[model samples]
Target: MQVGIFQTQEAAADYAAAHIIDVVGGATDPVLGVATGSTPLKLYERLRAAHAAGTFTLAGKKAIALDEYVGIADDHPERYRNVLRTELVGEDKTGLTDELLFTPDSSAPDPQAAAARYDEQIRALGGATIQILGIGSDGHIAFNEPGGSLVSRTHVDVLTAQTRTDNARFFDGDLAKVPTESISQGLGTIMEAKEIILLAFGEGKARAVKELVEGAVSAKWPATVLQMHPKVTVLVDEAAASQLELADFYTERWNARH
Candidate 1:
C-alpha cells in the first residue's frame, strides 16, 4: 500500500490519470473496475482530457461498474449504468464502447443469478487490471457498508441509512427515492484486481481516509481491506490527509517518487 498526499484535488487526479494511462499502455485487454460518486469525478475528467489530448487511448479497454441500484431502471439518470454511460462510456467522454462496458442488471428478474453472472464475466475477462475506488464518508467501499462481510462476493446489499442519506444528493435530495438495496462486487471480488487506486478529497473525507490509512484492517472500515492488497495506491488532497498521523511521511514518499 502507498499513500500520496497532493496539494490539490487536481494534482491528485492528474497523478491517478497518469498512473492509469501507464497501466493501460502495458496491459492486454484491461478491464477497469470503476466507481461512481463525486470523489472520482476529477479523475474521470482528467482521463477524458488525456484521451482528447492524445496522451492516452481508451480504445479496446473494458470496464465494469462497482455496484448498481437493485430497483432502478437501467436508463434512469441516477442508475449506475446511465451514470457510467454519461460519465465514462459516452463517445464524447472516455470512449468506452458499450460492448466493453459491463454493469449488473439492476432490474433483472433474478438479481442474485445476475450478480453471479457478472462475477463470472469479470473472471472471464481476466479480472480487473485496475480498480478505481472512492471511500464513503463512513469508510465503506462500493456498497459494502460498515459491518459488511470481508470475504463476501457479488450479492445484494442493503443500503445503510448513512449511505442512503449520502446518496440522496443524486436523487434530488429525496432519500426515500434512493434504492434501499444494491448489487455490488464483494470485497473478495475487488481484491482480485491487479491494481487498485482509491481517490479521496476534501475535509469531509478526512476521518475515513485517516482510518483507512492508519487504522487496523477491520471490517468496520471496509476500505481497510485494501491494506491487505498487494498493489493499492491511495491518493488524497491535503484536506483528506489532514487526519493522517503519517501525512508528512506520505508527502515525502510522493515527492521522492516525483
Candidate 2:
C-alpha cells in the first residue's frame, strides 16, 4: 500500500488523477470501478479537466459503479447510475460515454439476482483494471458495512444507521428518505481489481483512514481489507491523515519516491 498525505484536498485529487491517467493510458481497454458520494467529486472533476485539456481521453473505456441504492427510480437524481452520468458522462461531459458506463440494477424485480448478473458482467469485461474507492466514516467501503463477509461476492447489503445518516444530505437532509439497502460489490469482488485508488478527506474521515492504513485486517473495519491487496494507493489530506501513527513514515516514503 502507498499512502500519500497531501497538504490540501486539491493536491490529493491531482495525484490521484495523474495516477489514473497513467493507468488508463497504459491499459489496452481499461475498466474503471467507480464510487459515489462527496469524497470522489473532486477526483471526477480533475478527470474531466484532464480530458478537456486533451491530456487523455476516456472515450471507449468501460466504467462500473461500485454500488447503487435499492428501490430508486432509474431517473432519480440520487440514483447512483444517474449520479455517475451527471458527474462523469453527461451530455457536456464527453470523456466517458453513456453506453459504456454500467451500474447494478437497483430497480430490478429481484435485486439479488440483478446483483449476480452485474457481478457476471464485471467478470465478462475482465475485472476492473483500476478500482476507485472512498471509505465511509464508519469504515465501510462500497456499502459493505461492518461485519460483512470478507470474501463475499456482489450482493445486497443493509446500510448501517451511521451510513444512512451520512447519506441523508443527498436526500435533501431527510434521513428517512435514504434507502436502507443497496447492491454493492463485495470486498472479495473489489479485491479482484488489478489496482485500487482510495481517497479520503476532511477530519471526519480521520478515524477510518487510520484504521484502513494501520489497523489489523478484519471484517469489522471493511476498509482494512485493502491492506492485503498488492497494489493500493491511499490518498488523503492532512486532516484525514491525522490519526495515522505512521504519518511521517508515509510522507518520507512518498518524498523519497518523488
Candidate 3:
C-alpha cells in the first residue's frame, strides 16, 4: 500500500486524478470500477475538470458500479446508478454511455443472477484498470459490511446498522427508508482489479483509515483486505490520517517520490 497524505481534499483529489489519467492513457480499452458516496465525489469532480481542460476523456471507457441498494427504483435519485449518472456520467463529466456503464438493476426479476452476470461482464471486459473506493465509517468497502466473507463473490448482503445509518444521510435523514440489503461486489471481486485507489477524508474516517493502512487483514475491518492486494494507493487528508502511527513515514516517502 502507498499512502499519500495531502494537505487539503482538493490536493488529494488532484493527486489521485493524475494516477487515474495515467491508467487511461496506457490502457487499450480502460474499464473502471467506481464506488458511490461522498468520499469519492471530489475525485469525480477533479476528473470532470480534467476532461474540461482536455487532459483526459472517458469517451471510450467502460465502468462498473461497485454496489446498489436492493429494492430501489431505477429512477430513484438515491439509486446508485442515478447518482453516478448525475454526478459523473452526464454532459460534461465522464461522458460514459449507458451501454458502457454497468449497474445492477435492483428490481430485476432475478437479482442474484443479475449480480453474477455483472461480475462475468467485468471479467469479459478485461477487468478494471483501477477501482476507485471510499471506505465506510465502519471500514466497509462498497456494501460489504463488517464481518463479511473476504473471499465471497458478487452477491446480496445485509447492510449493518452502522452502514444504514451512514447511508441514511443520502435518504433525507429517514433511516427507515434506507434499504436493509444491497448487492455488492465482494472483496474477492474487488481484488481482481489491476490496481485500487481508495480515498478518505475528515476526522470521522481517521480510525478506519488507520486500520486500513496498518491493521491486520481481517473480515471485521473489510478495508484491511487491501493490504493483500499487489497494488493500492491510499489517499487521505491530514484529519483522516490522524490515527495512523506511520503517517510521517508515508508523508516522507511520498515527498521523496516527487
Candidate 4:
C-alpha cells in the first residue's frame, strides 16, 4: 500500500490521471470501474482533457459505477448515474452513453436480478482493468460501510450514518435526502481490479485515510483492504495525509518511482 501526497487537488488529479491514461493507452477496450463523489470529480475532468487531446477514446471501453443509490431516478442530480454522465461521459464527448455505462437500475422491478447481471458484466472484464476509488470520511468504500464482509460482491448494503452525513455535501446540504440504502460493489469485487488509483483530498478525510494506510488491517476501515492488493496507487493531498504517520516517507519514495 503506497501513499503519495500532492500539494493540491490539481496535482493529485494529474498524477492519478496520468496513470489512468497509461492504462487506457495500452488496452484494446479497457474496462474501467469508476466511483462518484467530490474527490473524483477533478480526476474525471483530467480524463476529459486527456481524451480531448486525442489520447484515448471510450468508443469501445466499458464503465461501471462502484455503487448506486436505491429509489433514485437515473436523472436525479445526486444519482451516481447522473454524476458519472456529467463528470465523465458527457464531459469527454466520447459518445459513451448508457450502453457503455452499466449501473444497476434501481427503478427496475427486479433489483436482485439486476445485481446478478452486474456481477456478470464485471466478470467479463476479467475483473476491472483499472478502478478509480474515493475513500469515505468513515473509511467506507463506495457504500460498503464498516463491519460489512470483506469478500462480498455486488449487493445491497446499508449505508452508515457517517457516510450519509459525509455524502450530504453532494445533495445541497440536505442530509435527510441522502439514501439510506445503496447497491455497491463489495470489497472482493474491488480487489479483483488489475490496478486501482484512489484519490482523496481535504482535512475531513484525515483520520479515515490514516486508518486506511497506516492502522491495522481490518474490515472496519473498509478501504484498508486495498493494502492487500498488489497494484494500488493512492493519491492524497497534504490535508488528507495529515494523520498518516509515514505519509512523508511514502511520498518521498513515490516521487522516485513516478
Candidate 5:
C-alpha cells in the first residue's frame, strides 16, 4: 500500500489522472472498473482534458462498473451506468466507445445471474487493468459493505440507510427513492485488479482515509482490505488528510516514493 497527500485537489487529480492514463495507455484492452461519487469527478475531467491534448489516450478500451443499483432501471438518472456515461465516457469524438461497455441492467433473470455474468465479462481484460474507487465513510469499496465476505462474488446487497442517504443527492434530494439494494463486484473481485487507485476528497473523508491507511485491517472497514493488495495507491488532498496522525510523514514519504 502507498499513500500520497497533496496540498490541492488539482495536484491530487493530476497524479491520479497520470497513473490511470499510464495504465490504460499500455494495456491492450484496459478494463477500468469505475466508481460513482463526488471524489472522482475532477479526475474524470482531467482524463478527458488530457485525452484531448493527446497527453494520454484510451483507444480500444473496455470497462465494467464497480456496482449499480439493483432494482433501478438503467435509465435512472442516478444509476452508475448513467454516471459513467456522463462523467467518464462523455467526451465527444474520443476513442472510448459504447461497444466496450457492460452494465447490470434489470434484464438479468436474477441478481445472482447478473453478478455471475458481470464477473465473466470483466475477466476479459486480464482482470481490470485499472480500477478507480471512492471510499465510503465506513470504508467500503464498491458496495461491499462491512461484514460482507471478503471472498464474496457479485450479488445484490441491501443498502444501509446511511449508504442510501449518502447516495441520495444524485437522486435530486430523494433519499427514500434511493434503491435499497445494489449489484456490486465483490471485494475479492476488485482486489484482482492489476493496479488500484482509490481517491478520497474533502474533510469529511479524513477519518475514513486515516483508518484505512494507518489503522488496523478489518472487515468492519472494508477499504482496509486495500492494505493486503499487491499494488494500491491512496491519493488525497490535504482536506482528506487532516486526521491522519502522520500526515506530515506521509507527505514526505510519498514524495520520496513518487
Candidate 6:
C-alpha cells in the first residue's frame, strides 16, 4: 500500500487523477470500478477536465459502479446510477455512453438475482482494471459495512445506522428517506481489481483512515481488507491522515519518491 498524505484534497485528487489517466491510457480495455458520494466528486471533476483537455479520453472504456441503493426509484436523483451518469458520463459529461456504465439492478423483482448477474458481468469484463474507492466514516467501503464477511461477493447488505445518517444529506437531510439496504460489491470482489485508488478527506474520516492504513486486517473495519491487496494507493488530506501513527513515514516516502 502507498499512502500519500497531501497538504490539500485538491492536490490528492490531482495525483489520483493522473494515476487513473495513465492506467486507462495503458490498458487495452479498461473497466473502471467507480464510487459515489462527496469524497470522489473532485476526482471525477479532474477526470472530466482531463478528458476535455485531450489528456485522455474515456470514450470506449467501461465503468462499473461499486454499489446502488435498494428500495429507491430508478429515477431517484441520489441513486448511485443516476449520480454516476450526472457526474461521470453522458453527452454533457465524460462522453462515455450510458450503455458503458454498468450498475447493479436495484429495482429488479429479485435483487439477489440482479446482484449475481452483476457479478457475472464484472467477471465477463475480466474484472476492474482500476477501482476508485472512497471510505465511509465507519470504515465501510462500497457499502460492505462492518462485521460483514470480508470474502463475500456481490450481495445485498443492510446499511448501518451511521451509514444511513451519513447518507441522509443526499436525501435532503431526511434520515427516514435513506434506503436501509444496498447491493454492494464485496471485499472479495473489490480485491480482484488489478489496482485500487482509495480517497478520504476531512477529519470525520481520520479514524477509519488510520485503521485502513495502520491497523490490523479485520472484518470489523472492512476498509482494512485493502491492506492485503498488492497494489493499493491511499490518498488523503492532513485531516484524514491525522490518526495515522506512521504519517511521517508515509510522507517521507512520498516526498522522496517525488
Please, what is the TM-score per model? 0.97, 0.98, 0.97, 0.95, 0.94, 0.98
What's the residue-level lDDT of 189 in candidate 4? 86
Clashing pairs in 5: none
Better of 1 and 5 by lDDT: 1
lDDT score at residue 26, model 2, on the 0-100 scale: 96
lDDT tens digits by residue: candidate 5, 1-258: 788988888888899988888787777756777778888888888888887887765556787788888877757777778777877564452356676766765446588788888877777556788888999887888998888887777777888877888888878878888888888888888988988999998887898999999889888888888888999999998889899998888778887877
Span of ten consecutive residues with least summed lDDT in model 1: 86-95
The segments of candidate 1 whose C-alpha lies over 4 angstroms from its true place after superposition are none
CA lDDT, every prediction? 0.89, 0.93, 0.89, 0.83, 0.81, 0.92
Task: Check candidate 4 and list the clashing pairs.
Answer: none
- Misplaced by over 4 Å in model 2 are none
Clashing pairs in 2: none
**lDDT, model 3:** 0.89
**Residues 1-258 of candidate 4: C-alpha lDDT, one tens digit per residue:** 667898898999988888888897797678888888888888877778777888756766788889898888767888888877877675356545667898877776776676777777788767778999999888888888999898888888788888888878778889998888888888998899999989889999999889888878898898898889998988899999888888768978988887
How many residue pairs of model 4 clash at the backbone?
A: 0
Model 1 lDDT per residue over 140-244, tens place? 999998898898898888999999999999999998899999999999999999999999999989999999999998888999999999999999998999999
> Over the stretch 1-258, how does candidate 6's per-residue lDDT look in tens digits?
999999999999999999999999999989988999999999999988987888877798899999999878989998899999999886456777789999999898898998899988888998899999999998999999999999989999999999999999988899989999899998899999999999999999999999999989998899999998999999999999999998999999988887
Q: Candidate 2 at residue 176, lDDT?
A: 91
lDDT of 2 by residue, 140-258 (tens): 99999999999989999999999999999999999999999999998999999999999999999999999999999888999999999999999999999999999999999999987
Model 3 / residue 119 / CA error / Å: 1.4
For candidate 4, give the lDDT of residue 26: 93
